[model samples]
Target: FVNGKSLTSTSGSTASQSTFFAPRSKTPNRQAIALISDHGDPAAEIGKEEAGGQNVYVRQVGEALSKLGWQVDMFTRKAKADDPTIVQHNPHCRTIRLSAGPEEFVPRDRLFEYMPQFVEEFHKYQAKHHYPLIHTNYWMSAWVGLEVQKTHNVQLINTYHSLGAVKYQAVPHRPAIAETRLAVEKAILENAHCTVATSPQEADMLRSLVSDLGHIEVIPCGTDISRFYAIPKVDARLQLGLKPTDEVIVYVGRFDPRKGIETLVRAAQLIKRNTVDASNLRLVIVGGSDPTKPDGQERQRIEQLVGELGLAEHTTFAGRVGHDRLPLYYTAADVCVIPSHYEPFGLVAIEAMACGTPVVASDVGGLKFSVVPEETGLLVPPQDETAFAAAIERILSDELWARKLRKRASERVQQNFSWTGVAAQLSDLYRRMLAQSIMGDMILPSQSAISVSLNPDALPNPSR
Candidate 1:
């Protein structure tokens, strides 16, 4: 339990928890920050049925901020009973999992009801640490930050990983909580000290659809360029037990209706029909959920579509590839497809590009900004099977053109989407907000400002 003590993972795996302290100055300055993501656990494994870009964003940003001298404490719900209550990533960074409801996995759409308990537990933790700065991820966490501001006067900086207004337009059936989400999103944008948009397009969406009252900053999401750097396609394929001569096309993401997996499957069918040697081409769908879950049902739907299109023989559902091994799949692929109906920031596109793979993504939202047409990758209309097929075929058919796109794709990611660079931009914003606080102009609740306590007895020392 995360009552007031740091607990290690049940398995006692060294990789699960980082050391308490790293070598640094005798007495380094401690600038603390609390990152709230109610459902997206920063310490959770990537590529899970529920885990996606938000989890990666939170975890990477926290680690990078720690490097820039901010003591980062990420707050997320404890999903499993046996999971570690706290996961330390560095001397200055840790993930604090607090219980809000049942200590089991819950879908995001139904998690809103547990938020009141989450807010209470979060305040309990804050009563001891008294953090004055909070950077929240997603709308659910944004609501928690809004509540905290009512009583704590903490500076609120938010990143709406997905906007409710924009998202509802993409799906056929909106969740019952759509109204609540839309209201909270607007409130967060208008009231937060600053809202950090992961892409310029997302910032535009905030102004046009959400609200225009609060300050907005465009800070892009990032990838580990070092881990995803160009590796030889032959070597990568060999490591992954893939054929060296096969024309591999990869799709890596959650099995959700909004992801547009059906579009990719249809494109693959078109490619097979239009190509000279269909037997040489392979389509790898790299993620799925347990057969009983909603996402799993979506996976079954995709599998059925693949079968109906006669792609069962040519396609493979590789399931969820581990983070360490994802780069291999990306590097081995001739082209990576991201056929999402909408995306605020397509983290997968940058990641594939970082691995020197050309991307063929839907020309929508942030994908338009991330994928430069005929340069790093090609963008086609969302759900346009013919256009997607053509874009992928162009890259796979011409080796020289594919090589050129691959080189520029890696260069583009290196220049713009490195985690360190993203963190620096965020660190600057955090400092600006703190400066405003010093001037007594920081945003606060309508009621009154609540001062953070300096009492050492409030909470256990986070450094421990």
Candidate 2:
């Protein structure tokens, strides 16, 4: 609406305005890099429980790549009724929603069948706006990644944020996903040009489970240090209407069983029984989930368990908060927790660090990689509520130690996990990859290749 075009939400403060599509960066190659996801953009005002992290990762990466002179196009399956088919996030990047089974809300767990439709629609769109390759996310998108590679000679790169094998182990006797899913993941890992790993542990797991020499690149995920910058704790709490004496514990993630929300609530119960200042401690659970959806089943189960334990008065469920507001929550929190049974890379830990807040995350998955024990944050066994409670109590009761931990956490993130730093590294990788992709084409028998080397006037089309 600012320039006769709908403004797709981005991390900007409106510096200037133009009448038409102004390229966000100098386009290095006219070739577009298509990013396919199952649930689409989380910043679009409607999102699911698992959609939040995926959305941030895709959009931030897309924006960073685009800014570094790549034509980035993020693609996702349509899961809404009135949602636009394409959302231009920045001039060089967009979110294209393709029709799959139905143009309505359908959970990601059930979207595997509509993948062929996703490929066809993607190809149809590509034929209209030609792009060379694709970068797809999650196992669901891996199905589409395989199909897209089969349809065209395009390269396929994938990121498996969470694995079915690990997730199935977290839930109690849950129904297994499609038998073809694990097979497809293996096939995709084998066939795809490259796959990205978020942590060393995940890369090790992949090498162990899939192949020893799997062509996976370890690119750990990042956080926006600028938005999550350190703020005075007293001012942060004041800004968020938190009491000066209140102790706040924050958990931000999906309501999935793997996230272990029940474990956090149970820990709160234990804290109440052991501590005198428990009345001042508050637990806030924030996520991007529709409380009415069937996906809320797990969330409701957590709530039920909380009420049954008589800890209902101490907990607040603030659902589907906007991305812009996340920093406030982290800054105002006394201690941020990630009780997930598994995490490929825990963004919350870095986010908490960026906010100068101490974290007490589970000692599993990426949490091990992110949290420095007794330094930045504490880690306990995944479902050990008693240990979790003890850690929280220790942080709140000792102000000096917690402040030191917070200072150390801030310094650690400033050194390692900034979006600007990650973007620069990723941009270099993309340029190298693109250069390699082009260099190989020059050695081919194509008529354009020889002509370009022979005559400067015949240097091939700049825009592919």
Candidate 3:
């Protein structure tokens, strides 16, 4: 049984896990909501070519919402044949992968053709178990949500993890589906009940670049404080097989050219040439890639560049560290660098800060919002090797100042960017949207209704 409904068919060749078996009487009493991330699978391993901040955001938000008495179902396209169709993260949250295209990995640019099948599967699921509200992630999923809204009595909320208008300005070559993505992105922003922008910068971009007609809210991305909190630097370094006295700088993200890994590599070279005692300097790049894929090919190029610069001895390609082990790399580092040309929300910056590590990130998009210059960490111009080297060297040279930055960085994340706090804000937004849908008005409910409606032991009674 799943969500108070009987499983009608389960004869697939792939192994199925009966993990969503909450008894009807004891199940969550709050309203069920669907989180649609079409290309980014919330359950997929982080650091994979396609998996990054957007994937982390959807998965973390779903699990966090489930803790607040929400029945969260995250839907994504089934990418691999051997992968399970359903993965239960908790009693209240699960990932449901639907069959789309050939059940193989397809780059997001080419995944639009398979969206009709995804929408059909979603409709089938909705027929059995209704989702009153659906929050869509990325432009592809936003299109699916818009299509679903046409046939179903559902409220749609969208978050464009990356905007095409903003992204296209950065890259030299544009994908063939760029026009379609832009159109869908615009329509979703204008037509959806609300569009959630992860940063104020992103919200502003939506109005100027996408559409000026949508209700936008700024809800920054959050990190798991419990998992990412400060581990002793000595212990973290020892575990990672790094010397305690080494001046370590870490880069954690995908291997995409737009991520500016090459810039970071060049910045490292500059540091080595300038620093008087560069022998103890270490650079650790953490992310996963498929050798046959674009990210893998990019990694090969970076490795070749590292060799050309004669920095291989100082650099360790710690490729694709798992989420469970990522905190160690962050904690062990003197400073973490996010050199992305654009980031809708820089999750790595906050994660590192949560581990009491300072950040030196590009001053663009969400990085500008997450990293407070000279307070938590410094922000340098995007793709500027000299600026990055100077900022990194400043932090590494001044241990006293770096310690102060680390303390404040951890404090800032705990006080402001905790997942539990972010979920509460999301819970309020969901309630307001649901209340509006019920009343057919712009007015929201009283404080009493919000408190009582979300109570775990009581069923949601909007009328009350």
Candidate 4:
């Protein structure tokens, strides 16, 4: 514990992991920015069922924003008894988990009832360590921002990690809370001080599906360029214990049906039939929860499909890989496939590109924005196994063309998708909003004539 605090778990038990906290005196100009991510825990390990792009987005953006002088505190729901109440990432950045309903995992669709308690706990935290501005992620936390705004002198900024309007279109059976989600998503888009869209496609979706009355900024998600870089494919494969003759195809992220892992598996079957030397072809599926958990059920279904296709010998389920080791997997792969039905901003596409690996992603939502048609990688229609297989074969067969794609892919990411770049864009947005409030020039929702200016190009225009 630092500075006499117990520094224990959310359940108030002694924690085994150590936390690093800065002395109170070290923080100057304590203008704090609170990031509320009710379901996405910033400190959780990546590739967990609930822990994917949103977790990485919150943690990376918080840490990077801290470097720019905002005292950043990321608030998330305590999903486990042993999870820490507070996790210090740096001198200026930390994650605080609050107990909402039960101090355990609740699927996001059923989490609305506990939001009032989340707001109450947030009020208590704000009372002790007040934050002038709050940035909320997802629909549930956006509602928390709205409730808090009624009583507190705080500005709310929201990032809808996944839009309900966009999601329902892809699935035949919508969740029980679909109507509620649609309503809340509309409310957040129209009322939040600012709504950050991770891609131009997301902004377009909001404009079309949700209300058009919102302050929208297109700030694409970023990756750790330092960690995921252009390493030689041979060296990467060697590190991962793969033979030089192997043709590797990787699918990383959670085991969700919408992620289209089944599509990838089917595509692998097509590749075997279409390509020569099919014996050396490999498909590495990386991510899942525990066997008894929700995502594990999806993984089991996928495994059954793999067995039925008779591709179990060629497919490898490298479950729940660590973030540090992800670069090796990306580098080792000849092609990285992200076959999500929809993505706000496909972080994995850029992460693979950062590693100088070609990507064959679904041509939907942010994947369209992230993956260039030919320069960086190919984009196949979602669920089209034949298209996916052909795209994969194109990269593997034409070595010269693949090399060109890999070089451009890495350059594309280096120029645009670094965490530092993403944070800078967010920092500019926060500063503008805060400055307006201090100067009494802030435009409240009640006033219809207010036009506040935001940096036109806060982040590189990935859309262009």
* lDDT of each candidate versus the true structure: 0.84, 0.73, 0.85, 0.83
TM-score of each: 0.89, 0.85, 0.90, 0.89
* Candidate ranking (TM-score, best to worst): 3, 4, 1, 2
Q: Which stretches of model 2 miss by more than 4 angstroms?
A: 1-30, 171-176, 438-464
Per-residue lDDT of candidate 1, residues 107-162 (tens digit): 88888888888888998877766676899999889888888876765778999998
Q: What are the runs in model 3 whose C-alpha is more than 4 Å off? A: 1-28, 444-464
What's the CA error at residue 245 for candidate 2, in Å? 0.8
Error of 4 at 389 (Å): 0.6
Candidate ranking (lDDT, best to worst) = 3, 1, 4, 2
| Per-residue lDDT over 1-464 for candidate 2, one digit per residue giving the tens place of the 0 to 100 score | 12223333232212121111244356333446778777656345533555756787888888877776677888887777688877887888888888888887776667776777787788786665545557788877876776665445454678887777566555566554545566666666666666778888887877777654336777878888778877777787887777878889999877787778888898998888887657787888887666677558887888899889887878888786665887888888989999988888877789888889999999987788879999998999998998999999899889999999999999989988877777777665554443434345432233231122112232111121
The better-scoring model by lDDT among 1 and 3 is 3
Q: How far off is residue 384 in model 4, in Å? A: 0.5
